[model samples]
Target: MEPVEINAGAYYLRQLRADRKLDDRPALMEAFADPRHRRYVLNYRLRTPDEATEYVTLRAAQWACDERCSWAVADLATGRLLGEVGLRDLDLDFGTAEASVWTHPAERGKGIAAAGLSAAIQFGFARLGLHEIAYRHDESNTASEVVARRAGFTRVGPEERPSPSGETLIRWVLKPS
Candidate 1:
C-alpha cells in the first residue's frame, strides 16, 4: 500500500519517513526522552539523538511492511510536529489494531492529541476497513485517558501488562463503533 495521510483541519497526519533522518529529530528526541512520557510508549527510553534515530528506522521499516503506521501530526500552517498518532499490532484478518498518541509538552492542551487520534481512527476504520480499533494507555496517564475520551474511545476496563520499567502496567482500551 502507499503511504497514507489524514487531513483534519488544524493538523494533518502523514507517514513517518523512515528512509531519511528526520529534520525534527532534536524536538522529537526531547519529547521522547522526557522521563514522564517514556514509559507510556512501546519503544525503549530514548536518551539520545542516536536512540531516536534508531526508533525512526524501526518505525520506517514497520510502515514499509504495513505492520504498523506511525503518523506525524503537524500544524497545518507551519508544519511543526505537534505529536504522533499510530496503529500498532495490526491484524488485517481480524480488522483490528491498537491506537496510540502522544503530544509535545507544549501542544498538550491545544487539542492536538484528540484531533490527531480522531483522524487516525477514521483512517483505520474508514480507509483501512478495520472493524474495531482499540486504544491502550497506562492507568496513571490521565492525559491519555482524556485524549482517548475526547477522541471518542470508550473504556473497556483495565488490563495488566509488563512495562519496560518492570512494573505491572494498567492498560485500558477504546473500541470504535
Candidate 2:
C-alpha cells in the first residue's frame, strides 16, 4: 500500500518509514517498564533493558516486512515516538487482519492512540484494500476498547483465549463499510 497521511484532530498519521532509525529503544523500554503500563499490557513484568532492545529489534523487523503490517506512531509536532499501531496476522486473500496499538505512558490520554488507530484503520480499508480489521484486547483493558470505539470500530463479537500471561482474554473485531 502507498504511504497514507491521516488527520486526526491535532495529530497526523503516516506510514512508519525505515529512514528513521529505531534508536528510541531506551525511551520505549523506560515507558513500557512502568508498572501501570506493563501491568495492563505486559503483565507487570518489566523487561531488562537488553531484553527490551531485543524486543524492539524484532518488532522493527516485523514493521519492515513488505506486507505493511506494522507502523510506529510519531508526534508530528515534536517529532517524538509517541506510540505504535500495527496490523498483524495479515490474511491478504481474506482481506482481513488484526490490529493492536500502544502509547507511551507519558502520551496517554492525549488522543495519541485514538488518532493513531484511526489512521491505521483508514489505511487498512482504503490503502490495503482490506474489507475488515479486527481489534482484540483483554476485556479489562477499558482504554483499548475506548480507542477501538472512538476509531469507528464496532464491537462485533468476543473470544475467550489464553493471554501471553496464561490468563483468559476477551477479543473483539471490526469490519469496514
Candidate 3:
C-alpha cells in the first residue's frame, strides 16, 4: 500500500522519503545524538549521513509491506522533522496493530508525539479498518505513557520481553469508540 500524507493541525505526517524531497539525514542524526533520545527511542545513533540515509530508506520501505506503515511527523510551517509515528506489526485479520512514536529532543513537550500518534491511529482505524491499536513502552519512559494515555489508550498490563536490559514494557490498548 502506498503511504499517504496527513494534515495534523500544527504538524503534518508524510512518508519518509530517503530522497532529496524528505532529506531527513541531518535532523535525524541530531536527534540520535541526544542522550535522552537515545535512552527512550532506541532509534540508535547514526554515525553519518550515509547511515541516516539507509535508516530512512528502510523506514520508508516499510509502507510497501503489509505489516507496517510509518510517517515522518513534521512542523507544518517549517517542514522540519519533528518525529515519527507508525502502526506496525499489523494483523489485518484481527484488525489490530501496534503504535509507535518518538519525538526529537528539541521537539519534546510540544505534543508532537501525541498528535502524531493520534493521527496514525485515525488512519489505521479509518483507512486500514483496524479495530484496536496497542501501545507499549519501557516502564521507565513516562513520556510515552503520557502520550498513550492522552491519546485515549487504557493501560492493559505489563509485558515481558527477552532482553538483556530486563526491560519491563507497559502495554496499553485503544479500541474504537
Q: Please name the candidate that would achieve the greatest TM-score relative to the true structure.
A: 3
Q: Considering every candidate listed, which one attains the maximal lDDT?
A: 3
lDDT of 1: 0.77
Off by over 4 Å in 2: 1-9, 12-22, 43-53, 66-68, 166-168
C-alpha RMSD by candidate, in order: 2.5, 3.4, 1.7
Per model, how many backbone clashes are there? 0, 0, 0
Give model 3's TM-score versus the native structure: 0.93
Candidate 2 lDDT by residue in tens digits, 78-108 = 5567887877777778899888888888888
RMSD value for candidate 2:
3.4
**Against the unseen true structure, what C-alpha lDDT does each candidate score?**
0.77, 0.70, 0.86
TM-scores of the candidates in the order shown: 0.87, 0.79, 0.93
> How much is 93 displaced in model 3, in angstroms?
2.3
Q: What's the distance in Å from true for residue 20, model 2?
A: 8.9
Better of 1 and 3 by TM-score: 3
Q: Order the candidate numbers by lDDT, best to worst.
A: 3, 1, 2
Candidate no. 2 TM-score? 0.79
| lDDT digits (tens) for residues 1-177 of candidate 1 | 566878987898875543443355666877887767776665666677777678767778888787888888988775677898898888888988988889987777899999998988888888788888777766777898898888887787766665555644445455557
Write out the backbone clash pairs for model 1: none
TM-score of 1: 0.87
